[model samples]
Target: MSDHTIRAEAPGDEAAIYNLIAQAFAPMPFADGDEQELVNRLRADGDLALSLVAVDAGGVIVGHVGFSPATIDHAACGWFQMAPVSVCPPRQLQGIGSALIEAGLRHLREQGASGVAVVGNPAYYERFGFTVIDGLAPASEHDQPYFRAQAFDRSAPAGTLRYAPAFG
Candidate 1:
């Protein structure tokens, strides 16, 4: 709800984005503590399909959301994975994260992306239209409960969805 602008990640934004993500996830019980590195790896491998950052009125980076190409059944299916959505500790719970996610999804829709998948809290992500597809699922069984998706076009594809290599 703060006065912030959501925009694509720009040059020199990496460091700030990195710190922001790290700080955001550090307190989460389920965080793997490698999210920051994952973002770096995604960028390094050119697998970052989309990365958006939220800058507050003071020009401070407060939130970020990343999207990467994901394959369905071992083949590109025009689908993407949304991950590592982060909001600075002090800026969180204020709708900044949701705003970042909406902006990223909007951009992907505009680019004609087939759909997007996410692994997270069902109650939270479901608000964005993400749902568990009967046949579509994530690679890891442990992620089954958290996996949710949204298709931009027609019905969601049914198959095993794999995240980018960096997710390994």
Candidate 2:
């Protein structure tokens, strides 16, 4: 069994987190190298809701997950958007991703977030209670099961899920 713990990311973890994210997501689709840009923008914009990491027993960062601010028009609803979730290549499928996601969602709930959105696999995210928002358009054309949402508290917003400009 892998010895791992999930916790909020720290300032000291910047380098490790960057390296882990680059290595883990180097093969995926979507904007490449934009992960770091998104992270930087979120931090600079003061919109990061939660930045979490999973570390092994030896203190190696193996996974990272981030929840940033998402909004829809005039409503001041707190929307959590999950992206750039990365798990070390060797650590993939060992539950690190799931753990990070769960921990991040829990943290968002405790922080009083109204809802959370994700642009990811529905099959995988469904385990965390995510569901398709009927009648809700995605922020982009890419929105589908991959761009889904789940209400950590009450129901999710019924309109489009507008991600931050950094996502553009």
Candidate 3:
């Protein structure tokens, strides 16, 4: 992880970030071919709570992560949703995604987020303290096994974990 640096996303990273996300999830069966569009809508709608990127020694963007404000009952709680976490095609399993998640979570905490939710692999996200919460998930994947949450407040909220309108 020392070889890669994680930082907040800056201007001029849109294209690279889009490409990286598209490339990373290109092989996934669950992908709706809308990951990049989701990120774009989040950004355009000012719902992107945190956008982070991992750059290698040469300053090449190898990974990216986006956390957007989520609603429990339609914007009633201070929660965030880890939208899309992506690593370059050749850079998978190299800790780049982990670094991005760690840094992104830290930033969310600093921003006073109460909890975070994600629709991701349980095995990989559990290391970050994400666990499935009963009845806590996106509208479409309600109560699915892959839905997970980690509360910085130590008390995860109840209700549906509604992502930004972009996720729809």
User: Residue by residue across 5-118, what tens digits does model 1's lDDT show?
Assistant: 998999899999999999999999999899999999999999988999999999999999999999999999899999989999999899999999988899999999999999
As for candidate 1, its clashing pairs are none
RMSD list, candidates in order:
0.8, 1.8, 1.5
Candidate 3 RMSD computed on C-alpha atoms after optimal superposition onto the true structure: 1.5
The order by descending lDDT is 1, 3, 2
Evaluate all candidate structures by whole-model CA lDDT and list the values in order: 0.94, 0.80, 0.86
When summed lDDT is taken over every stretch of 10 residues in candidate 1, the lowest stretch is 150-159
Per-candidate TM-scores read 0.98, 0.90, 0.93
Could you tell me how far off, in angstroms, the CA of residue 113 lies in candidate 1 after the best superposition?
Answer: 0.5
- lDDT, residue 125, model 2: 88
Measured by TM-score, the strongest candidate is 1
Between candidates 1 and 3, the lDDT winner: 1
Q: Runs in model 2 with CA error above 4 Å?
A: 29-31
- Per-residue lDDT of model 2, residues 1-168, tens digit only: 459988888888877887887887787776477786677677678876689989899988889998888876635588878887899899998889988888888888888888888877778888998878776557578576477787766564677778777777
Residue pairs whose backbone atoms clash in candidate 2: 120-146
- Give the Å shift of residue 93 in candidate 1: 1.0
Q: Model 3: what TM-score?
A: 0.93
